[model samples]
Target: MEPTVASRPDPTGLNRRALLQGGIFAGLGALVATAPFFADSPAAAAAAPGGPEPSAARLKLTKFKDPLRIPPVLRPRGQGGHDELTVRLRTADVTLHSELPPVTMWTYEGVYPGPTIETVSGRPLRVAWENHLTGNIPVTAVDFSLATGPSPDPLSNYPGTDGCQEVPGVAGLPPWAAVHLHGMLTGGGNDGWMENLIGPGDVQLSAYPNKQAATTLWYHDHTHHVSRYSVYAGLAGLFISRNAEERALNLPKGEHEVPLILSDRNFGLDASGALTGRSVHKVEMVGAQRLMRPHHGPYTLVNGVVWPYLEVEPRWYRFRIANTANSRIYRLMLLADGRPVPGAFQVIGSDQGLIDKPVAVDGALNLSPGERAEVLVNFGAFRGQALKLVNTFQGVTPGASNQRNDLAEPDVMQFRVADRKPVTRFALPPVISPTFKRVTPEDLPHDHPHRWVVLVGPGSANLPELWEMEEIDPAGITFPSAGIVQVQDAQGAVKTLRRTAMSYDEGRAFTAAHDGVETWKYLNLAAAPHPMHIHLAHFQVLSRENYDVTGFDRVTRGSARPIAFKAASVLEAHELGEKDVIRVGTAGQIVPGPNGTPGELVTVAVRFPVVGRGVHHCHMLEHEQHMMRPLVVSPAAHLHRGGAGGHH
Candidate 1:
């Protein structure tokens, strides 16, 4: 039987008495311990030809031993006025598993979470990113048909026809390399265009003003259609912008601050016992043909180490946690002896910068892919106790019902609190970055555009192949894809938008007036949640609305019925702060509407202060490679100029 999307938990069905008695969170440990383990089967081997087979014997649960690896800081190597930094992209062997050999990985400066680029907020940091990798690309297990380019008819078996494949004599092609400063407000050329890739021996120089506020940003490979594979092979790093205001607060500093960059990978060994990256794809038999599906890995790694341990002092320590996983949602919590520690985490900052006030959270902190959280954990009370950083959401792929039990992915990293003070030089502040001004509904202009961004995926339920392109006009207005948009009239009957495919270049997706705040309603039409991210500027979520999904799928397939949209609650505490990436729930997961099951709708207000070109789309690198759309934030003065391609 085909798997159905899990419905949202009914609030009225929850037992308040049991939760108050600590039965809910306490029962989680028992459930994980008693969960069943499934070994590899014959059918599983048939699905992935080169991927790692899921076996019960490969489970490394509770195997925390080695010390956590801290990435080295990449300081500028020039005089005060001008700062110069250079990095080389080369292949390095990294040992992820104790039993397995070191895996050959593509990294920047020969490190997984490559050297951290630390710079001041306003300092000018210019980087010369060099590509030194030669010969065949390290990752081999990929479906070329899923390339970001337009797909050919099913009858044609043309290789390299997809947007990302290599074509003979195509100047400056693979061994391609590019860097995208995620969450950095920079110019268009330095924004890392997927089309502007450099080959081996070529160096791409980017000048970052570091004008944005101090925060934990990241840099990763955004090289054309193969980014999903390049990043999987380890070409990513952390970029931190430090400022004086953040320093005066006296929050954890120096040794007390730790950067926890999280990611997951699957490894396979070759003849010489050398480890190689493995890619997994689900195979489904559609009639007599086979189709490949996208999936997530089984092993989780923190700072390039698999289930590592950290020795910590019994004091307040600040942890900058980043979820670098390709497609996993982690509800992270600090567990002491398999039970949660009350009031352990004090969330002080987020992706953009520090919040107005520190939020004391005692429960799991939900984080999707590409999301970052600056949290303070006071180990002062847990002296000599072993605390485990655990993830509660357990699912291998999208749309699968989440098993709260974490038997398979229980511990992220273990922290052994010291019995004595290692040196208490820093203390937690009552308030952090108190000067942050939140952009509210009242702050937006009355002329803000009410735009709708509909997330589309593969129409077939049997395959995980996503819809490769979005409907965009040459003039930069994205229309809903045919069969995806439905309208209700006065007669109370649903009508579908006329299905028409229009050819548009990669750059033309959306046109937003410069310095103008716009409200965008992101409606997920797919069967799973996507982390929608906007480049160039941060955005504030206005509210959430519920819309019909069961009717949407049917309407997109020619079945139309009346549909009604309902208003949901405001943003949650964690979501109230400024964020560049937001997790949007799919259409079939919410409560059923008059038409049928509805998807969740998130409305966010955004404004681009700088006039330039940039793109905004899903942060899920897998989906972004093929399904993301671009944005042209034109200056107010540029609107009076030419229509298409005016920014250039």
Candidate 2:
């Protein structure tokens, strides 16, 4: 088959809305118009023609027949000594809809979610990530323009292609692979540097020290410029780092504890149950270039099954919930037969691990992409009730509504309460891990460095600048795409923050001292809130402050009228634990286009536990592809501390 490319439209008399409506390409437009991709699927049939139509009623009312598939737990290879494992990246076919044919997917070990890797803290392991993928991308619909790039690095040495030119599939790029253990503090070589791409037949070996607290970490593809598509094709999984302290808590285990990997997927299938070679791509007219913005699917998948149901005994159950969606934000709540169940949810842990105590969730649990919430629900009271986990946030498109407040995309999964057994072993203590220590500003050393992280928006008048930060090879890399924002200090000095200039320039942006506490003030300048993700170590949120956005622009210009600042609410219960991902601002509340949320600021205290190099980027995979930059921990700054957050 010949490679397909979208023909750019003439911009003479076009407006952004007109372009979004129909300017991608005559072929793509025809396919979208004629395709009833989700019409046959019950979960997505109620969505509007253009996009997801938020429907609380539809979610609360619909009942699914397929039971939820729980991902199998993958334990370490060896019991005691150094463990060695091999994770193969390859292609497989998965069934999303019961009636539809299996959709061809790129996955780790051929499973939709790969497998849940369970390990212990202090038990280190090594993995040889092998890439065994080749041939054309199976999906028919793609914005191939965004996937291609210049020459790839020799380190990413794929078998046969020259990096200098475009290849086939999405973005005319070959399938390159890199594995990132999202929240692990391993060596610089193991942190899944975005520039380190491995292609077909290549093997990349990395180590995990497992030195951090017992928390839920994840692994996924981080290949330069292709992370969004790669992960979308299913190269992601959960890694549970446990320890004696956590095991002693005696929480639900063996069929009682579950890992709920949540995500939104837009899939099209042909009659043969294969993913229709086409995808749901949304285009935007930015400046003179038309860019394909991130796509949000109408269907929600739990453990890779669409709108599935799970049988649960009428007792307390522990759920480790992770939202892996590319862009969807979930305001998760539980409903019974179309009505909201009040005070039914309790959170025992945040991203890093078990909190000092359990906090009752008064309303829905709000989780963004890459955020995790460990929740407990007691069905002891309603043994026979049918409850549905639902999402109410309706920002399917950025800065836009779901049309008429219609609940078009809220259904998650269903839970049918089963008969209670004679004995109930587990119980929720009013306080959990009571001795859990909380970090205070006074605990920070006097000489700790205070850093500034600013999240910016797309650049004005530069459409090509919106694509992924180029790969490392000088022959393939582009210096400046779009500058997300400028990082500044109290003295009014500014540094433009963009992708790394060179692949190997580890200290391009900033470096952290080992074992030193750094106060990171994240100024959210983008219109949408970004889930700022820091690798290597988890951090504590200090405080959030809102500024007079309009006045701040002038303040930066030397019009010193003292920009008014407002301290927001105190840290909530769920946010008090160690965290690696936090939404820096209120999503969808800021102005649209290349403007930053000059008024919002989120401050966090981060301590680099291990000496390594990693990249800190927005967790929204689409944004990260275009904006992530390198962060390094110098070996010279190594200091022996008690442990990361005193876990030792």
Highest TM-score: which candidate?
A: 1
RMSD of 2: 14.2
* Candidate 1 collision pairs: 149-163, 483-556, 587-599
Tell me how candidate 1 scores on lDDT: 0.61
- TM-scores for the candidates: 0.75, 0.74
Whole-model Cα lDDT of every candidate shown, in order: 0.61, 0.61
Model 1, span 1-648: residue lDDT tens: 111211322111113343224222221011111111122246633432222222223343335544566765666644468676777776655555444445556777665677677778887778888887665555534233433432322211111122223223322225788888888877777778777887889888888778777799899988766776677778888888889889888877776788899986544434654434332221112232233233345556787776766767888898888888776667777877667787677888887888878787746777788888888888887777778787664232321222222124445777877667545566667768877877778888886676666665454443222222233322431333344455443345543343332112433456777777888767665556778888776787777766655554432442244234554644544576778888887312223344433566688888676555677766676666655656777777677677653645
- Candidate 2 per-residue lDDT over residues 281-380, each given as its tens digit: 3222222344434445656778777676676778888899998887667777787756667767678888888788888776667787888878788877
In Å, residue 354's CA in model 1 sits off its true spot by 0.8
Deviation of model 2 at 201, angstroms: 1.8
Instruction: Show model 1 residue runs off by greater than 4 Å.
Output: 1-56, 60-62, 78-80, 140-174, 269-294, 394-407, 421-427, 460-481, 484-508, 555-563, 570-572, 586-598, 642-648
Candidate 2: regions farther than 4 A off: 1-63, 139-172, 269-293, 394-407, 419-424, 461-507, 552-563, 587-598, 637-648
Please report how far candidate 1 places residue 292 from its true position, in Å: 5.7
Location of the lowest summed lDDT over 10 successive residues in candidate 2: 27-36
Per candidate, the number of residue pairs that clash is 3, 24
